[model samples]
Target: MSASLTLVVLMAVMYGTGVYVMLERSLTRFLIGFVLVGNATNLLILIMSGPSGTAPLVTGTASDDRMVDPVPQVLMLTAIVINFGVTAFILALIYRTWWLAQLGDEGDTLSDEHADDTEAATEAVFNQVDLDDEAIQRVLDESNEHGDDSHTTRKGAGE
Candidate 1:
């Protein structure tokens, strides 16, 4: 059976709105968008499953065409479980962010401790490697002065 136009339109709207909401910086909005997108995917699967039919296990049913397809239902259930899991994970993240925000003087900003830690980590990585352009150029020049043959020895031309 053909999919209904109304459901298709609704699904499209849901998908569009979900994507739009997901672009926001707020974790809550992202969670809402994720849920909307998940439900829209379920609707899409339903629309594509075709017309409903009798149970596949029903006794005395001789024709396989009349049996309902179970794949779509299974997929929908799987999607639901996955959505729930991701929602929980997002909630946890939101809670963690809120907790961190609370520790700072600003209502929405991270604490100075976190910022200092981040800066320290970044400095540690770059300073340990001496990643500045001048240092890199000096290292390259030193390696050249050492000679390329340091890595490999060439045989005599006649030997």
Candidate 2:
């Protein structure tokens, strides 16, 4: 088999794996998939340039047939850097999501059983309150007695 054919097969497998993992709910799996896809793309770029015959440096005696293309190598280097940045950004997003959810698990935390319980408790509390009733009038009267302004003018020009 040719190098190009092998590279194509490898890239296809990598992309397939990445797509499968991306559908998963785990953040770690998602990151792994992203890395695999990135590496496959980099390898594809290298393979498309054909075999590297010689060094890119000008030795003054090397022939054109012996010289290899340097553009692919340069592009690969840039791609690697960009991939690193993307991975870092993805990790940061996962960390932030974890912090907000107060759990180490990835995906939607609201789908968890504990979140359902919390929602039920909140609903129970809200059900006891009549928002349109005169109970709010007593609360507003107390606030007014404490010198609280229900409608105050702002000093800003936007108001």
Candidate 3:
């Protein structure tokens, strides 16, 4: 079945922009990219469903060949629902990340205090994971006994 040139080009553009945006380090950009890609996928399904005809509702005058297929329309609705759920999940992630960073209304400004807090939080997580490994913990303990102050451990860690 033939598809519209305009639609194909628009889909291509959407896909390209979505991928580019998703590659960024920002979670908000990733959300926007995911939305763009999801809508483009719905458009793709619509295009593949063949040319539009009469409404899917049965009418005495319209034959089967003149009636539009409803499967793609239903699929698009389902895709929309899935996209909404995923969007909500991503929004929650953004909120949690912001909360963890504990930023104020400063807006995009990472002060030294905030940066150090974030770094310490990250290091704490990594150190906890490392401590769970027995061999790594032994090495850390041995290094500490030898007067090597490089490895920093959190208080009450591995307790």
Candidate 4:
């Protein structure tokens, strides 16, 4: 019916689409959702300002009836720039994720062989330290001796 009401409807539709797209797992859909949300927010701002009253600039013989509210327009400009930045960043992230996915390393959801390798590596790292191993014992001894020597040297230098 009214222009303000139409804008409100448009904003609601945009928000609904955004919410739906955000639920999707695909990165493209998520990006679209973010854009939709940004647009919806911008539209809401415009609608809340009501109809433009008159020219924003002051004139020598200006009437009070028609001065447009320039605040919403300024806000909309800033919001558009911010949205553009966010969209660009999202696209870059999507590109990086796609590149990684294509490189045969699909993160934690790997194939059987890769999963097995990952499990083995994780187990190896978490395994108990074997103090009985001759090499490990020797390394530990060396480190202790080095530490003692360093401490002695520092003490002597301080004195």
Candidate 5:
């Protein structure tokens, strides 16, 4: 097959696959679809760049017609790079979504129980410590020097 025909066929296949993948329910499939479409777009830009020719160097005999169009090449390269970055971002989002899903609904319940246990343990330790007024004032004074606001510290329910 001719080069143009091959490029056209490839682009069509990629585009078709991209559209099909995008219709799936999964985010991972969506990312794949996006990548296929982006690749197709890059191919389209490459096709628009026209046939390869000698370097565009402006010599005494060199004319614009004999020179290759650099604009399309530059545009195609830029588009491919941008598409790559977008694909990476989309992949990251997909990974995050999958990770969160894997955590399951029970994870929240477990985390809540763990938090409760931690709070109870902290309270137990606090009750065992007997800080006199002088010690408390010294801690507050030190906290001020360290740029910490003593008022923002968590207070017990009785306090």
Candidate 6:
């Protein structure tokens, strides 16, 4: 097929793969997906830039149609910088996630039994009380006794 047709198909495949991989729970997969999508975006910007024409800043006389719009090129550069920053931030987050997940031994695997156990553990952790009523009352009472001098203590509206 034609070059443009090939690029369109490639872009579409990139978008599809990016979306599919992003849906995975793995951080590495997500990062790959993000990069794929970003690359696809760059390709889209490049393709939409239209046919190449004479340089806009050429000294010789040139018709308006012959001069390329440099805005898309500028935008593509800006997007590249922005994508770099965003990817860097995401990479940091992925590193942190991987580091945290590495706390367990090397035995951790995505087996069905492990998944069930993980779900149970997650449920147990989530079921824990976020706030203890008695503890909150004690803190409030202490704060009141101290005339709420602590900066971290929160006072009720009526108090």
What TM-score would candidate 5 get against the native?
A: 0.61
lDDT of 1 by residue, 80-122 (tens): 9999999999999999887566443433235565666655664
The Cα RMSD of model 1 versus the native structure comes to 8.8
Q: Rate the local accuracy (lDDT) of all candidates.
A: 0.83, 0.78, 0.83, 0.80, 0.76, 0.78
After superposition, candidate 4 runs with Cα above 4 Å error: 1-3, 105-159
Model 2, span 39-142: residue lDDT tens: 98898887787776878877788476688889999999999999999999999999987756753333223556676665566555556665545678888888
**Among all windows of ten consecutive residues in candidate 4, which has the lowest summed lDDT?**
102-111
TM-score head-to-head 1 vs 2, winner: 1
Q: Which structure is stronger by lDDT: 3 or 4?
A: 3
Give the alpha carbon lDDT tens digit for every residue of 1-159 in model 4. 145667778899999999999899998999999999999989987877767676787785647557777888999999999999999999999998974563344234345656676656644543544434766889999999999999999999999
Tens digits of per-residue lDDT for model 5 on 2-25? 258889999999999999999999
TM-score of each prediction: 0.63, 0.58, 0.61, 0.61, 0.61, 0.60
Model 1: lowest-lDDT 10 consecutive positions = 102-111
Ranking of models by TM-score: 1, 5, 3, 4, 6, 2
- Model 6 misses residue 155 by how many Å? 18
Among residues 3 or more apart in sequence or in different chains, the pairs in candidate 2 whose N, CA or C atoms overlap within 3 Å are: none
